[model samples]
Target: MSLLRILVRVALVALLSMAPLSVAAHEVQPAISDVELSEDTVTITLTTAIEPILAGVDLEGIEDTNDSPLSDRVDALRALPPETLAAELAERWPEIAERITLRAGDTRVTPVLVDVTIPEVGDTEIRRDSTLLLTAPLPDDGSPVTFGWDAELGGLIVRQGDDAQGYNAFLTSGAVTDPMPRTGVAEQNLGDVIVTYVVSGFDHIIPKGLDHILFVLGLFFYSLAWRPLLWQVSAFTVAHTATLALATLGIVQPTMWIVEALIAASIVWVGVENIWSGGRRDIGWGRIAVVFGFGLLHGLGFASVLSEFGLGQYFIASLISFNVGVEIGQLTVIAAAFLLLGLPFGSKPWYRRAVAIPGSLVIAAIASYWVLNRIGWAGDIPYLA
Candidate 1:
């Protein structure tokens, strides 16, 4: 066999081996904090996975704890019982506390730990969340306050007040929130909201959204012609956008695992169709319809992420901006693929045999495994769990 073929087989084997670990083994999600301001105190109740924090893993721009040098330490911390872990965090409180910033105008306020709530150790593979309740006394002059933490702690959603129009913002990279008002909802300018969420949506696609990237690639592999690719993408865009809106508005809600299973299945369907069709230049209307249907499933998946972090009072604006970012990311993927593959080798007679077919085979095989894993058919296999 030629070197290219040998290389392909090796790459496929590596992918298959790593497929199960991609499911959420040690993925780092953003931390969320609910800030409540009373006359004398500013209290923040933060909900986050405590293992990475306790293990001293730097979470900046990281998705998985395994990517850090301290991943084994993180896993070890995860095995500890709730009380044990809480006590460990208590021991580290002084160091952790200094990293948190609570400012009331020019005055720096220090917050004291009120409580720590860690869930009992369950499945070690699955993430377990812990809560921290910290409260600091307000300034005597009643100055508006702003909150931030070490960027190494990862992204944070700061929600002040309980109203729907309350001040809400996502802070990352050492960014702090706008000064929160002592009275009613603090107003966030429209332009800032747009920029924040657009970046968020784009980030989700370019680097963070691997599964979505593969699905888009599956769409691309179906045809090299612009018209066919455009039709399928347009259908997908419309369908996912609609469902993303519906789900965010709380109109359509499906069990999250079921949606995830169906999304993996969609990838399988698209990949299989590409291989069977053998790089057809024209797409059938039926193909467009199927793609649209799968897009709806994918939209629900998108909404699930948003729901976890929240959109706050700027729900409509954030939702629209995020979708726009996702579209930009999708187009970028297609453009990159075209420049690399379709532009260079698409006209060759062997392109279909050498590129599209084998690529689709890999996409299908990996997604097929995902389907089994997502639907619980794979059981608690040691590596997968």
Candidate 2:
């Protein structure tokens, strides 16, 4: 544990120096990702990283495919009118509606795709696997053009063309998510969103994330003693577990803005407390109480996650398992922290000042900075390419 703690400390110092804010944001969502497509088809394909919640159901192109060449796609598209091309593809795959049109202020579009993929998991991509042979006359409009007439699809319609970089341009990395709810769970096409939400949400509360990791570390930093450390961990477990259940079950809610603010605040509290205080403060149960309170806020945050998912089929099992999963992930983090710092302390008096104090201060500083940035009080934190 002591040696691992040393390595963790070393890594944190190195990463923070390289690109603290940008790397931190990337922990939640990639700022920008690339996708590749052929130059001919009005169809789109995605090649990028997406949070796991989108892996299922949210397809970018076709669900299955072949090593079809880009040229094959181009030649097929050029030979057919746009309507015939859309209809034939719809006949084969069926995800696309025959006619979809909408006005977005001035822009209107219709969508057609040859395939879809979630590359973040395993370099997934959907390519144009076959040609769309239409027995109708081609429109001489010069490009894959869309009309101003309204039609059916998503609330709006759009497509890929030359101005979009190419006829075979990289489409958006986002999957077709359900409409955002105005109040309770909004009805969503949960072909896979449910499982994805649970899995990725679990992953989010783990290693690649520095802020929450630091918060978990803060929970352990105060105890240079074995018994107190045990008690604190137990209390934290109970509190987080209670809230995770309440939130997942839809028993609570906190505005998205406040939940993030408090998360930042929780980190600050643990870090600052670790630095200045130690060895059995007069208020013995104070830390436990504070953690319990923060756990409530975290629970509300958790509920929002499940609520947004809009899936009710596996509610009971998913709620329980997801809560258990969160606890396991949290404990794993604390275990790693102990391996790094615990053995070195071994109930030593000086260990508090030398390691715990300094470490806690650093964590607090980072959390406080996050709070400032989130509230828009500071300039946008510089991110990486």
Candidate 3:
């Protein structure tokens, strides 16, 4: 069985690592680029001079304000035509032009996924910023070589030849700068990094950070008993918190792969040890100390999201809110799990075998895959950093 497991792991690693033959062949010629086949989603960013608008809106309870129902506001906004939105903006145009502008039309007036992030930038007064994420599937066989977009969207659309390209454009007071070209990378935001960080951090909790979700779930599963669960959670919290703080302060730059690998390992060790090892009383604090150390690594892994968002300005507030948002996501997961899995199913025989074992196996296998994949022992193409 041991040999079989080892072989399976080895083979899986090889498969994951194997370079796609087509990609390998074309990787060097004419400086091959990543061709985005479709606009899985397009993000539109709007910038404005925030200090003045801060008066029309409240900043202190920004998150709390969102709690009120916005269905009516959404409907009203969505009902307005692009022209109406432009006219409405015309009223605020002078100040809007003074602060910031959009290359694309800002008047979606639609109930799109809009995020407003407020943070104080350097030497500048505290202000508000907004980000809009727009995702629309692409048409069949149509590629975008070059394209232009109208401000009142459904109005002006531009296109070039048959190259499927996605664009990120920034509209300022005077000219439209192709941020895509400026960054030489697709969709890299040069907005108020602080706002971007907060928006990204919040988005990650629900949408992008799947690994973090699994790790938190693994923690919740071990001894779902409140006391034991609380102990582990607290330990994990303290450790990650310490590391997150340190990493934000520039004390660490550990590779994300290692952090992830260790995170998986931590889950496996805790769960496997829980199932077989007799009593914690027998093990000294030395073992506990080891976990704390690993937790520190995990913390930095968590902070990777925020750090990638950039420390620009308002690092402190952004850091605290991001951490709070993460904790909220974590607690929400546990709360939902307990409601669904614990209350009705905790005592049943099938629950333990069905839920616990399968859960652990999945987590272990995933971690093992990540470890092998990261170590490059898998036969996969090397990606440029």
Candidate 4:
């Protein structure tokens, strides 16, 4: 077989390896926890979609519950009535409680389940949140407290103290919070806030934002030439940054479904252009304009995730840091593509035919599936739904 044929087979195998993740369209969101400290007791009210936990879905490094082996169980649990689900959770509380961690200094404390409040099931497609109320006795030595849970429970956002003051942090799976005082938790400094948001942003792209990853890869496969790629990436960065700020500030509000559908379509557009452009290194202004427009859609996607982290008092700093992280992620993707494909094979005479075109076809095919899936056209399909 020829080199192009062998490369094509390798590409197909790689695509097949990613088939498991393609249907994982529904994102597993982070749970929000509010920690209140009293003289002798500490109370935590956590609101999260309890179905995945009840269904035994392993949430560590999982972007969507549908990616779990127990996804069907999660679906069934999601359809349960509020009271029924609450009862199931109560029955499972013994095992679940053991996974919770409430520490005062070096001493671990057991937290008792005080109550659970489950809401009426709305759209089954949308995650239904249930609130878990837990209380634990504080140590008498006046030691600071920390909170965390098993990494399999996924990411968490903790808000300690009142609305005006306290510590706010997004903890990754299996991670612990900084020591929080019993009363009047100090507000996080601006420097710390920047670091936190930046990591969150980068995490979204590297691990969680698979759709965005494919889109960036699509851009990378377009050409090996640096100038054209630079122009397109620069346009994309500027446009998305503007819209991320606008959407986050509530200045521009667009329907989420439309934004998502358009984002998938944008990926399809770029992938198709890579093949149709016929190995042209000089891109026109129209290409840059199209990329800029698509960047606006992608920014809205970022805003949706950042909104979950809640900016608190460091809104401006957090937003800028998050954007910086996103740029870093995009640059990382570009760099990897250059190292793997461009550096080794870019100078080869048949590189476009063997690599770029075949890769673009794969990207286009996957994104076309996403477009159909997002718009509800292919929802009935079993695995790729």
Best by TM-score: 1
| Residue 7 lDDT, candidate 3, scale 0-100 | 44
Candidate order, lDDT descending: 1, 4, 2, 3
**lDDT computed for candidate 1:** 0.82
lDDT of 2 by residue, 1-385 (tens): 5774576567445423322542234322211111112222233232222221111222223211121233344334435544564455456433323232311223333344444332122111212222222111222332322221111111111222221121111112423323212122223233343344445456546633455566677777777566666666677667666776666555555577677778778888988877666555333678778777776666665555444333244455455655655666677776766665566453565656656777777777777877776565545445411
TM-score for each of the candidates: 0.91, 0.52, 0.47, 0.83
Sliding window of 10 residues with minimal summed lDDT for model 2: 148-157
RMSD list, candidates in order: 2.8, 15.2, 19.2, 3.5
- lDDT of every model, 2 decimals: 0.82, 0.46, 0.44, 0.81
Candidate 3 segments whose C-alpha is farther than 4 A from its true place: 1-199, 277-291, 380-385
Worst 10 residues of 3 by lDDT: 23-32
Across 1-385, the per-residue lDDT of candidate 3 in tens digits comes to: 4554444444333422222211111111000112122333234333332222322332222221122243234334334454454345446544433332222122221212234333333211111232222223333333332223223111111111112223222121123333222112333243433343444454455433445555666655555566656666677678878888888777787887677667656656654654453123234354456557767877887777544344433456556656766666667667766665656656655555555555555655555555554455434535421
Ranking by TM-score: 1, 4, 2, 3
Q: What's the lDDT for candidate 3?
A: 0.44
Stretches of candidate 1 off by over 4 Å are 1-21, 377-385
